[model samples]
Target: MSSAVLHRDTRFVPKKAIGGQGCYINLEDGTKFLDSTGGAAVSCLGHGNEKVNRMIKDQLDQLAYCHSAFFGTQVSEDLASFLTESTGGKLSKLFVVSSGSEAIEAALKLARQYFLELPTPQDQRTRFIARLPSYHGTTLGALGAGGHVLRRQPFEPLLAKNTSHVSPCYAYRGKKDRESDADYVARLATELDAEFQRVGPESVCAFIAEPVVGAALGCVPAVPGYFPAMKAVCERYGALFILDEIMSGMGRCGTLHAWEQEGVVPDIQTIGKGLGGGYAPVSGILINDSIVQAMDKGSGVFRHGQTYQGHPISCAAALAVQKTIKEDSLLENVRTMGAYLESQLRQTFENHPYVGDIRGKGLFWGVRITWAVWAETFTDLYMQLEFVKDRTTKEPFDPQDRLSFLIQEKGLQPEFAVSLYGSPGTVDGIRGDHVVLAPPYIVSKEEIDTIVNVMTRVLAEVFAELGV
Candidate 1:
């Protein structure tokens, strides 16, 4: 038999997900898997949401697609309005797109365009400064703006040199034991300032950062005062502060906009995943009033656009998702449930010998596993599993060991039947390993407990089996 699809790992064929409801996904072969991370934190409302599905169907029945350049749809306009208003009009204009990558692509272009639209056009401002352990997207432009080392390595030659990176605000590994939170923030701020100076501040367009570090670094939130410090540097350099809330925004971090908690407003922002709640492929860029006015007074046009830029059905679905979140007062639930999750995690993993750090906000949490410690703490388990070589000095197992991948896979076994989102290279973009969990905003306390219990069991079994 021949297959038309090209899988991520050709050797490992994945089971089909036939259906999903709430937090569980049913596989083709009848296995029910509780999704703890919502497939990279995309499914905020969880699978099979009736309201979202109905909205999609209603929109489809009315109208679906049209060229945005020639037509404006009510659903698209409403979603754009809702999103801009959600930011208290700080982000004055919205450009809807199909995915997070495209939203970021729009942001990159708009940043350059914003500079160009200035009274004294900053035509030389072409570069972007992002942070390491960052993942903006996979498209060439977005890829260049990201600093996920391993992902960028193979594509280095193909990627543009328009973006540079600084250290991410990862307190677990980046902060020193003797350093205070303020001092750590100051140090990271200094690093950003120096990078801007090194890159020639005058020529830079923006400093792009995830409000909360997402996949590349697990779910690391910046230390207090970090964003304000970073924003100060960008402002001093006349650079726009671009916050990538693609994974951590839209109530994922207990707030609609992650920056709200940081007490900073970005000049530009990109959001996805939770926006459409995995009901539709929708993402968008929200431009500040200043930038929008500059463009309005100047060329009155953004040079870039997509054919499916605000597809009617996509916007309708997203609008419904947002409405449901608001009407149900789910952000309150995120706060309530998020606190519960944090407590549960601390209770479960705080003293686990191999669990080095547990950090995050709201529902977005990361568990940093010290694999070397894993071999030491569970000598018998290590002997039975026997994947890594060294058990001391914090040395990671060989890349071939694929510890993170193995744990992700192992979480789905029959005994546990739970799912987790795992990523490697948390330490430097190639060595450290961590697991991220972003349960649905609607997750119940009972469900949260179940997720924790299932995850704990899965971890134990993975250590014993080296596979999920």
Candidate 2:
């Protein structure tokens, strides 16, 4: 072994990625694995897509990069047009950036700028209210906007001030047993209203959230009427409503925008992940007509700008990704296969002692495990047979339990499925984990069946070893 310059984050060894294509990865050590989580849900079309690669090659042939301060490229403009066109006329403007975090930073800043169009000066704006356990981004500005306590703890002192947090519409955890959906929605709305009052509604520029709670909450959609209620409250205070669709948009959730599923729409939206399909790094903000009109009449130039705001190559790749989705009619596969996947998972894990929750929409799904849920017990099969048990099966903590580590040690590539979307809850960021499963949009129904079969067997095998 040779010494290399060391970086931080002890999560993984500094290994080289040898090759990857179509939901699989090859390590330099000759290990192969399925990328089910899609590289933190970024690779919607999978890796090494030929069309996307070809488009990048074509863009490089024309021009690779252009500083946004000087010229506006055609590729970027067309990509923006595609984004707005997909939104069905309401979202009319797009601003591109190189990453999701940048997109979020722009969204927050743009909301405040939109309010500046009012006679009130910028100094009058000082507050941002976001949902708890939601992750917006890593930059200080975006971090300040986010409410994931674990991610923000280290930089708490350095984060910008005047940011407040409110409850997320995570009905799975937040809703009381006796509470009806209507009552739950009303309660959350009241909480939001109370938060605005405390923060002084006029001082609040925006209320931000993920349409589908991504990493922090494990692919949870809000209860019915949640978004509409939230939107109504934001309108009452003249504050912008921002939806972070970075993890749930661009057909990953079987919709162009997850907000489309809700009765109401957001004033501004942040999208990435599925945008470039991992062919190129790109993210952006979609501003609604009202916000754009405000800026058009007030100060025209948005206060925020990035050096690589509209990278030609990234835009070209994203354009190809969008085109492939349209031509392939992949959203049909996503919806049909999503239902099939849900059925398959429910069947495989329904009687299992450890599976607490199997919930999500479209291709985005998660398997939540509680401390009381142990897979090995195989106890009371009849008791576990109910479709929606809503029972707690506390997971076993043997202190020696490390199932993923065992899988890695085995070096057996998953043929039926990519890697599991794994996480621990109630134990901070690292513990109390569960696995996530998000396959490619082009995934066949047979592929969905296979993923469930593999996970069923894998977990069973792991638990057998643990003697649960």
Candidate 3:
């Protein structure tokens, strides 16, 4: 059969998914694959959750759509209130949007408008600073703010020039040998400060970063004190602090908000993926009181609107998802299950030759693959040289090999029957490969064991086929 739909990769049409239940996805061919990565970490509640389904159905019966400029829906307002209250008023307002990218676009625009509405109107603040090797979103404004090299490459000329990059707080690669966590954090803070100065501190709008980097860096969590230091730098420059939690927040990291563990609250936060538990396309931005107050006093308007900004069905789905998490105590399960998953991963692959680093928080984990073994004694420059030499050193696989994608393909086979989230460009923006595991929060110990077991066989098979 010829398909008219344009798929992500035009070269190959993907297998059709017929249904999903809990942690497994059923294909049209009758194969059931374990969904260990939650479909890009979006299906936090897994699939076919009855409560969320019922909520959406109910909302459909009531009101399905409402244009933000003309009318307001109770579901939208309720969802916003739930989110802001979940933050304990630290983030005082919410702006509903349809996807993570749209959430980021809203954040960027709001940040710019926030400054414009200030008493003195710092309109000169047009620049945004984000970390390298981070994924924000695909929209033009969001892409410009993100630092993922490959994603931004083709659109480089079209992207806004207002955004600049800085080195991420990647302990595995960025930290020098024998550097204490404090010194490492200080170095990053100094670098951020320098970037602000270089870009004219007074002209910068915000310094945006993901609390736990996803996709581009492969689930890298910053070392302790990292965010606090970075936030301090932003505060020093009077620039807003924006945290992109599209992949790592909404209880994905064993907390309602990933920043809760970092000891810093962002002035503006973008959330998505798990927000609606895959039942609906939904995402939003959490704005702090100061920014909300500024707009309230100045323009009393956000200066932005989308036809589906507060779509009723999407809000209902998200509201139900959040309520389920709280009532069912899924976060407790996440913490317990996350610990078990971490231990299992370490026990299985801590010494595996192809595996270089294991990193993550909660159920969000990444197994970084490398051809070379890493040692604590190696200097930063020495490591770089080793990577250049490829095999027999702690270097990333060649980009052409597509090791991560191959592993993912293998996981879907009947022999493996697991859906692993494999990604490339983990080292720089195009060199390294890694597989992320973000099973549903409702996942069980038995399911975790199955995921690890399948991954073990899948990796060995792929590497052996490559003769590595």
Relative to the true structure, how large is the alpha-carbon lDDT of every model?
0.82, 0.74, 0.86
Can you write out model 2's per-residue Cα lDDT over 1-468, one digit (the tens) per residue? 444546553454555678887767787766666666676777888777888888899999999998999999999889988889998888999999989999998988888778788555555776899987778999999888887777888999999987888888866556787999899999999999999999798889889998777777667778789999999999998888999999888887777678888877788899998888888899998989998887888878888887788899989988999999999888877787777777776777756666666667778876665433222111100011111122463432432365434432322443433467554332333444456677788767666666667777777676677675
In terms of TM-score, which candidate is strongest?
Answer: 3
User: Looking at model 2, which ten-residue stretch has the lowest summed lDDT?
Assistant: 378-387
CA-RMSD of model 3? 3.9
lDDT of 2 at 236: 95
TM-score for model 1?
A: 0.94
In model 2, where do residues sit more than 4 Å from their true spots?
A: 2-15, 120-122, 371-390, 393-417, 426-431, 461-467
Tens-digit lDDT string for candidate 3 (196-308): 99989999999999987888877788888999999999999899999999999999998999999899999999999989988999999999999999999999999888888
Runs off by more than 4 Å, candidate 3: 372-392
- Candidate 1 vs 3: which has more lDDT: 3
Q: On a 0 to 1 TM-score scale, where does candidate 3 land against the true structure?
A: 0.96
